[model samples]
Target: MIALPFLKSVAPPLQGKRIYLRPPTLSDYRAWASLRAESREFLAPWEPLWAVDDLERGAFRHRIRHYDDEAAAGTAHPFFLFRNTDQRLLGGITLGNIRRGVGQNGMIGYWIGAPFAGQGFMHEALSLLIPYAFTKVRLHRLEAACIPSNERSIRLLEKAGFQREGLLRSYLKINGMWQDHLLFALIEDDARAGK
Candidate 1:
């Protein structure tokens, strides 16, 4: 069996050409809230409903604490995606529910702020992030599920080399009701071969 403590100790942070991935900080609260509030319209369809209080800095601090604990425990790695040149917070990316032993896998989740969508920053981040997950983390596979209607997200994942595995009937409760998601995955060997 793979050792959990070793994975926790060696969890890697990924940096991309345009974005740098880092652990969340309290200082990021205002920027995070501002981005979410401004992008509500753009992101609401894919995300869970947000309470009015969710936009407050205190709420964001709570979220940071949760993410920090998950990352430290090796259960997840939640990174704030930032523009490397300007250091502007663009959005967030996370690899969560990381499993070892017989699974050797993890699930990926991410979002880009409203203003930054379609700018190709996420594509760059994922391109770098996936390799780090596979090679450095030594995971056998990475998985992601996207609402079928999210054309942009589907395209982004495809561009980053994930293959469509199948559809999960009402796989997730998103934005309130159950929603179907197209499951996608990339095996480490396939990714290494540029497939």
Candidate 2:
């Protein structure tokens, strides 16, 4: 396992008032696929184009394996957000492209099931995740990018204390098309200031 230089010990599951985040497992395929299938239309606009077998169990298993590999390499941390009350899978979050040494930073991305949208679940999950990234993961900065039309995501990022940095032209491909995105960032000092 490639341990993070700043991480002296194993980190615990990130817990919040309404949700908890844990690494995805093979056993989570059924629930994950079901939620993604149900939320396909809701998520499509903000996500990458899905392959024909995206929701297949085999594909999901492969995703889990990839996540595990990334985590072990200390390049990313992928988590499934679950409701604490019922243990329902609400969404997924990833802090990817982690950089150490002089640049202690990572990029954050997330999605929520359609049924769970408009709830405060994601907010709570992010609250827990930000602190973990800053403290346990020792990230000095966390970045997020959202499509220009994604108002909800923009608001969520702002509410979580991220500052709108700039806009990137054709920054990423979403649903098979290159899309412009608004960049946002939060630094460790910003969190310390309670922003």
Candidate 3:
């Protein structure tokens, strides 16, 4: 198995009141695979179609390499959420598609295992991540897009202080189809004002 902590020295783990966020590691394959397999039906609607080997160990290694490459390139940050008390993986969140220079922005995407849904974990994780995006990453703006039918995601982003901007027709290919998404955004100043 691959070792742990390739990202520790780079970004380190972020801790909140009830949970923490850290970069995924090779040692996480089994738990990650198991949770994703079990939650496949629950998560598939909002995500890209999975490859035939999506949960296999080799695919996991490729996934890690992709994440590591993005981290190195400053294009994305992917974190897995773990409960503080038990360290159980509950979900994952990503601040990706980053643009610096004049843009100074990043996009957010996330998912929670079906078993852990509606437990306040994502709320806390979003709380932790917004600050990380604004302060630690020094990003000027963060954005999230969700299918209009994804009421839960809409609520989560709004509760985290994201303001709806507009809708993009066929913005992302989800579940193998081009789907419309409502766009939301939060700026650094807005984040500070909300605090």
Candidate topping TM-score: 2
Give the per-residue lDDT of model 2 (tens digit) for 63-173. Answer: 988887888777788889999999999999988998887998999999999999989888888898999899888899999999989999999999999999999999999
List TM-scores for all candidates, in order. 0.93, 0.95, 0.94
Looking at model 3, the pairs that clash are none
Least accurate 10 contiguous residues by lDDT in model 1: 4-13
lDDT assessment of candidate 2 = 0.90
| Candidate 3, number of clashes | 0
Candidate 1 residue lDDT tens string, 1-195: 766543563345577877888877899888888888889889989987887799887788888888878877777878889998899999998888888789989999999999899999889878877887876667899999999999999999998899999999988888988999999999999898998
Ranking by lDDT: 2, 3, 1
Give me the runs in candidate 1 sitting further than 4 Å from their true place: 1-6, 9-13
lDDT by residue (tens digit), candidate 3, 1-195:
653332222466999999999999999999999999999999999999999999999999999999988988778899999999999999899989988879989999999999999888999999988998877787899999999999999988898899999999999899999999999999999899993
Clashes of 2: 0
Error of 3 at 35 (Å): 0.5
